[model samples]
Target: MIDFLPMTREDMVERGWDQLDFLFISGDAYVDHPSFGPAIICRLLEKYGHKVGIIAQPDWRSTSDFKQLGKPRLGVLVSAGNLDSMLNKYTAAKKYRSTDNYSPGGQAGLRPERATLVYCNRIREVWKDVPLIIGGIEASLRRFAHYDYWSDSVRRSILIDSRADLLIYGMGEKQIKDLSTQLSTGMCIRNIRDIPGTCYRTESLEHLWDYIEIPSYQNVAKNKQEFANAFKIQYLEQDPIRGKTIVQNHGEQYVVQNPPAMPLTTGEMDEIYDLPYQRTYHPVYEAAGGVPAIQEVKFSIVSHRGCYGSCSFCALYAHQGRIIQSRSKESILREAGQLVKLPDFKGYIHDVGGPTANFRQPACEQQANRGTCRGKQCLFPSACKNLNTNHSEYLELLRAVRQIPGIKKVFVRSGLRYDYLLAAGDREFLRELCEHHVSGQLKVAPEHVSQKVTQLMGKAGKETYLKFKKAYEQTNRDLGKEQYLVPYFMSSHPGAGLKEAVELAEFLRDTGYHPEQVQDFIPTPGSLSTCMYYTGINPLTNEKVYVAKTPHDKQLQRALLQYRNPKNYDLVYEALIKTGRRDLIGYEQHCLIRPPQTKQLSSRQPRPEKTDKPGKQRRLTPTRNKTAKKQAR
Candidate 1:
């Protein structure tokens, strides 16, 4: 059972509740996914015997929820993850004719949205002394100094904005555990500086500490306006092992130091993966029916942490680190066994992946360092030099899962690293994958088409994706069955604008798989890419780029990903004409307004399918696979 920290100070007084195990003020509606930060932290707190309550959709517009979720007996955890907030525009841009243009769930701002700080400020209004602990993508991404795209200016550190006592970045399991245990014992917040994975401002106390190394990507010390200029940090947590400044909280006088990044060791990784979890999939659709469990499969198993394919937009590398760490095989399998025994026992496991699912322990274990990562994510722009690209251990792990009694099928639903899949000594392994693994679809994130875009994302060559595609096709044919690589991509990223997005659209249009759902880039405050989005330059490379920042241009840029969706037609047309984006107009109109070639033929001959279906499908294949072949060519 969880409590929603209610609104009103008297109500807090009314509850008259004494000390609590833990207090949780959340940005999410409490969907329990381990990778979904708040849930993991809450569950972990419970594991530590801390009673926790939450404030879902903490409508800053209304302060009622505050009265109920009073100050913590132990401390407070503020996470706006799952259903979290960022620097998304609280107001809508120009409304499209169709309501389909609304920004996805969390991006368009709170229904009566306010910034996290606003929410935190509202809470402090009721209980100012409550120890506030903050983490989650929203907070973590903005933990350091960052450029606020919506405000068109630099912003101060998230600690200043949210008014939290301490900000815990990354996956936060271990760090949070330590924070909770330490605070419960009456350790002052200022004393938490020495703890690993924590960032806090401290009062100068006779410099009572050893070399307190700060991180290179540590929170930027800038005022709100100058803050936007602070968007250079990349990995939110330690992706490898590195750091920046150790300021004395009393005065500005501080020791600016960067520690060698500490990567997660294999044993530490195991503790994370082995945490108890309920993997049963709760279908959102089924809840409406009162049937309880949805028809979808739930494969509740834990994961070893760390992912190396650090996509610029992803926060996993920051939280989990890039090094692969796993719990004992017995521990993972044990969880698998528990899921199989659930009421609607299934013979399959839905997924067993993280970051880039198949990535395993560092390829070469002989390196001087085992885990070396700074919270600034590395998996996004590139694999770490110390990354274990080897898939042998992973293959064995998957193989072992299949041997579980009830697991008739164990699929790799997590997207695969296609580039890594194509490496030498790995093709045979990949070939073996198609032969043995794979349920129906193997998700792959060839995030974009343009080499320029892929380069920006630290992805492998377009050739790598193409080779994987060809090999996959070849493998499927050899196995004599049809399977697919469901590719995942994003729209409106920092490096993408109308031309790039359209080029991607054209690629998709030619390939015949125009995505209907696309991710509009949300310039989360702390991401390196967010810095580039606001500053028009890659901080890492210090290179300038043309950014699509206006509302109208952003809409068109986002719409390009789903050019075939009828709902996007109106907006795309307006976007194209206004932005001088004629190149994308034809495809936009053709897909959204005009009928397809098949539709034209069908109109002429109602029964053409009986006689011309074969040829027609052949004609469609080129267009369908054209995007697919772009890399091959």
Candidate 2:
């Protein structure tokens, strides 16, 4: 009993013949996106009668839309680091290559039918033998054996390059309902690799754990990679999990790991934001008769979930758990009364909240480990009370989602830590959470304005975003109204060098917020700002701080924190007059110049080994108005 979705296309043409059924496929491109983790596995497989279909955001170059959503059906759910790979060439031929299709929103392009896992291997070359299975967060952070900031390369083991027959990974509806009751009482998919959040396809390295009851590998022989380093591993192709050798019993340590991931239930997240959605846009022009209502509006809820603000370039405190966990203000006013009965129902509500919806519990209510923070900031010097700083129950869950019904405005539009709500004194519940969940602009990250780069980037204190930008501008001029606060800014993190990215581009040019879209740090894989951007000194602050950790010094300190044109000032004055960094050459062509890039080195010629062969990876381009120096003729 665990699914709750599939609105029409004939409710998947009447259970499209249950045979070998279970097709969830989400590679996370936020499809018609409702998610309480895909509506409790599509309403618990139609409440136990079994027959599901939710291929959301999957145009993995058509396997006839997974053969019209059913048939010879049984396995294929994929998550664990959910899809994004098509090396360069924006939408090469196109099927799915978006990561905000290259704007200032975190790079990810490749789609010459390169949709996640090459559009699931062209739908397994036309369903050759079915059973794909991958699981979310881009297949649980690339499933194992990592290091690949857009092909900086170490790769292997996303169950061996998406040739996936299995790999369920964390927080999936109890191992996708026990692999659909062991493939409906028959179980192929290789005798279902001992189920549980499965990882499958065995033989030479067999070992399965029947779901870890502890002790299979000869009892903790030197704590198996420190107990496989806190189970946050991710891979879709990096391998090495098979027999990296360890087999013990009796004190318990069979140690191969990869199973225990359940998590979900606020009534399956209010039946996934109260199901029945219709948010479209060019869904072939709302199937003719038009109603694109600027991308078929409405439907975007989440009242809350994990995130106690671990934020050292977040992985959501090791994948969702810093604990804020909400939902209940009449279950978010019954999902805003089913998102105002669609028909592109945009009376506006885009966000309900989570991660920072004014954190409600855990910076103090005890969930200890209190270890690991090797510097990407937060050496913890404020915001205490168990770090779950309150929001007076998110201001009564945003005043019962602004008294629902035909809702015309509920917007909290996520993110507003502003130094843990001024260390949880709650400044009158952050001024009634921005005069009742702001809309005309509120975003807020203040990622860095320098208090030693906001404590090396864990955040809070740079005068706590100017005391919540002066009590959110005197409560929007004492409610005469007119919002605006936006402010996110991140520029070259990991103890931001180049003198703290030019004192954070002169503190976003004295707060007028110019060229302000800046993030450029990308450490990724379970970030602590990728261990201070691969070791520049923060092994627990033996502090030698200074890291722009290369990519041409993180694109010249994120182009001088969003520097303005003048041909990015002759490529930041020939890469800062060849790294002598001549004080950012009078702040380059002004209007907040960038200046860094001057290399002409030929010290009489001998350059070759720039990087080739082995895992073969140069890839990542996206530099746009290239500072040119071309050579591969």
Candidate 3:
């Protein structure tokens, strides 16, 4: 019988345990699903014969909650849930988000801002000297001194601020297991610093060998150039196979980061995902309507991990790495079988992919031994000659899952790399995807259509997206399905000024696309785009880039994307005027918006006489009575 990991002391007592080997502190509600990182790590630790318990979204206001589980015999693991705490609590506009999906009842403010630091500080007040470790997205990306958008200043590495003994960076299955083994052997947490995929602070450099030292914290904090240079080195050396040890000085102490943990093999990936995950939030959250985040992944399956898409704004390159690690077909099928047996299976498999769904294998054969090619992207600018754009294995897995009994439809809701799909020259996958997987609409992230913007975003050119769009529409038509393509667009990304935003608006106008939601680029820590947003220079190329920094500037760019929305008329009008593109504000068919004077004039026009006969109604001219035309429709 599979059950959630012990959350309260009574849970441990029920299992005939008086103490825990490790107590995990999370910034999210207890959801023991594979999609949640804390659950995976806790379950893996349990499998290793070490007693583990979790305290999810503990009250950081006092040490009483931190003391509920008492101190673990080994250490305490801290994570800011699946997402960065700040990102989860705030939107791009730095406004407080109304709800947190990871929290029970979809309520917000359960977790404090800078949650890892806050939780760790509370733990210190309670236990004083308990082994403290921090990981997950928050600590992983902030393993070095970098910019913090919220504070609008450079903050030190999370290790230094949180005062953690060790910081585990990537997908931490290997690092956590290794750290557990060493600790089980009675090694002190401070001495267990040689593990890969982990970071530690040290005052002495004598013990460290074969490492590249980037700019110091003081240097990066004050100098934008040094900041970009440091990020450049970190970005290039993120691979597991060929990456070297990276060290950065923070005043008197130094933070050293080991090469990332190797990508999981097929069997290893299987074992991790196959672990006894209850596949939902704990029963304690039942009263609060359960953790809202579980709805998306409850009936879904993760077929792979990691991505090589290398979108500048994406943090997958820094966290999951560029190498792709996919589970075997049998493993995915087994999970799908479990989903079928679920009490609320609903006969639909929501998703069967990860980070970038279509990426099942590495970009090239050389990645097996050499790691991802440094300073080069597989799908940016254009598909590399060495790229492996195969979809046979993934297509086969999808087909197999669909064959499972009790399954009605298996959809690929995760992101699809259309460029890779088109490059493969395989129409069969597209046809099958259109005929079966699409659930009325398929979402793709084109981000932007302007050549300058797309180039800066490290996405494929506009031509590629146009080709894919054409192919997708045609495939759906041939399948006799009316499925639509929902393309996601971003605004105010670095290099996107009024000129570029207008270009994107024109593209949307031309394509007859009115996106309901527009993503305004947020400069989160550790992504290449964040570096660009901060330094006004592309870290990779050291070229100056335009950044829409002011709140008004960002609003204008965002409004331009949704120009058709009546709520955005003022911003759109101002943007068009500012860009000297007032030509776009006229009543032309290609215009993004109608001029204010024209709208006023049309509103002032008299209403036409009511017609009793359907075909005998007077037709309104194109120029006059625009309001009457709207009312007639």
Candidate 4:
């Protein structure tokens, strides 16, 4: 019978199982959605005929709560929910968040500060000898020695801290399954260290055949340059086929990381998604209010996994890898068809994409055979020469989904790789996107407009975004649609000084697009940008780069994005003066903000003329044109 995994002892008995083979512990409340990692791993184990039970958000203060489901015969699996615990509970400024959408009733502080380590520690206290395996975004990203933004120190690999017998680094499907099978067959955890996409602690390298040893934990911690060098080596070895066995020394022992798992074939993705998932939180949480994280994804579909658009600020490369694995059209359609039958079906599919919405296949044909090139990116600094930029397959998939009987709309809310879209020879996809998928607004991340900053971000330069902007506007005009491109921007990233922040302010002013919300650069672990933030040097080139670390400097950079807001007037003024662009503070027609004033300023800021109307170009009065000509002379 298809049912939710056993969450309690009664549940275990209800399943007619004497004991579970695995007891999966997580920080977030039990959610069976595919987007949830614990759910996917547990369900995959169940599919393999192993009985699994879930212990969601157990009390970390004591081990009593962990005893609810009882111990497992094979091992105990742990994860820090969907997000990193520290990242989920705190902000970039090191402030606690009051709400956690992943929790039941959307409550905060249900889980401890460092969830992965806490959960693993608690599991050890209860069942000392059971195999402890940790996976998920938190564990995956922290699989190696890296910088911790919150603590402001170089921490050892999570494998060493959590004391998990085995750490599955990437998407864990292949690794966990293989590891579980071995454990069930009576193989010890220490003997199963050679599995790809996993990490383990070893006393000596004698057991390892071929491996690349990174700088020891002490060395990376003592010297910033060594830290950067170690990060560079780890970054280069993430590919599934080309990646090597990366090892790092912790004091007396070593932590060894196996190469990433290969991307799942389309049939594999189909089988995983087709599992018997309840697609909602356990009924016990219904009174407290179900999980708030399911709202956006309940009716949506994950079209693919992995991203080639390797934004430096993102952790997809560290967690999902760079390979793009898409589900077949039949599988996506099947999921859409199922969504239509849901009691709350609203005739709208919230999204139909993954890491990148439009990316359906590998960036090039050779990636499947040779794996992605470790050093070179497919679409950064400019699209690579070997990149195969195409959108026909994705366009066709959208068309097929739209034709499903009860589906009224299919929106691509996931971030779209605008540079990749622009590079494609087919404008038909753009036309189709503008015509159907968009629901009055399409959001894309431009991050920054300055070439230096964008390059540091590992994103395409502003020229590419501008080209895409022009094309998007033209497409909207041709389709007679009034949709708006709500571009997302980030501030205070490494390499973004006052100069770069002011450049972004000017772009916002010139475009007449005032973002209601702007993201400040957050240095999450396992990203190249985080390396720069911690070391003040680009690991790729070993060149010194400016990072805005002070609270005041970060505030100024953020204000520059919203320069028109009166609340940010002082910060914006300070940034303008600091950048030596004080001329923009006046009351001129093109000025970003007016000079300081005691009285309250109007909330409505002057916008670019062309932006006020659809399909209209900015026009200057004859007198104003003459004034401009005289000024030029």
Tens digits of per-residue lDDT for model 3, 1-633: 127788888888889889999999999998989999998999999999999999989888888888888789999999999999999999998999999999999999999999999999999988878899999999999999989999999999999999999999988999999999999999999999889899998998898788899999999999999999999999999999999999999998999999999998989999999999888889998999998999999998998889999999999998999999989999999999998988988999999999999999989999999999989999987899999988998899999999999999999999999999999999999999998899988889999988888898999877888999899888977878877787899999999999999998888767767666789999999999999999999999999999999999999999998776677778989999999997887656677777685554333322222321111224457765665456434
Candidate 2, 1-633: lDDT as tens digits: 012245235555564544436666543332343443554555566556676666544445456665665544666564422333432222212233444321112334313322446646766786768777776555555444444455544344455666777766545656777777878787887666655444554444445433323322222223333222322122111111121122223221122334334334456655555554433321432233332222322455667666645666776654454434455577667667766876667678777777576654444433333322222222255644434455677777777777776887777767767776666666677666667677667877777777776776667766777877877787778877776676777767767666666667666556645542455556665455554555444534446567665566777677666544343455455455555656645423332432233232111111112221111223334452232224211
How many clashes show up per model? Answer: 58, 76, 0, 0
Off by over 4 Å in 1: 1-19, 31-36, 46-64, 67-71, 87-115, 203-240, 246-297, 300-302, 363-387, 497-506, 509-512, 555-633
Model 3 RMSD vs true structure: 4.5
List ranges where model 3 is wrong by over 4 Å. 600-633
**What TM-score does candidate 1 get on C-alpha atoms?**
0.74
Q: Top model by lDDT, which number?
A: 3
Clashes of 3: 0
lDDT of each prediction vs. the true structure?
A: 0.57, 0.52, 0.89, 0.87
Question: Model 2: which ten-residue window has the lowest total lDDT?
Answer: 235-244
- Model 4, 1-633: lDDT tens digits are 237888888888877788889999999999888988888999999999899999899888888889998889999989998999999999988999989999999999899987999998888888889999999999999988889999999999999999889999888898977888898789988899778899899898987777898898999898999999999999888899988998899988799998999899999999889988888888889998899999989988999999988899998988888999989999999999989988989899989999899889988999988999978988877788888887888999999999999999989899988888878867899999989899887888989999899999998888888898899889999988888887888999999999988889888777767765789988999999999999999999999999999999999999888776678888888888787887987656677876665213323343234332322434567876576445434
* TM-score of each predicted structure versus truth: 0.74, 0.31, 0.95, 0.95
Task: State, as a TM-score between 0 and 1, how close model 2 is to the true structure.
Answer: 0.31
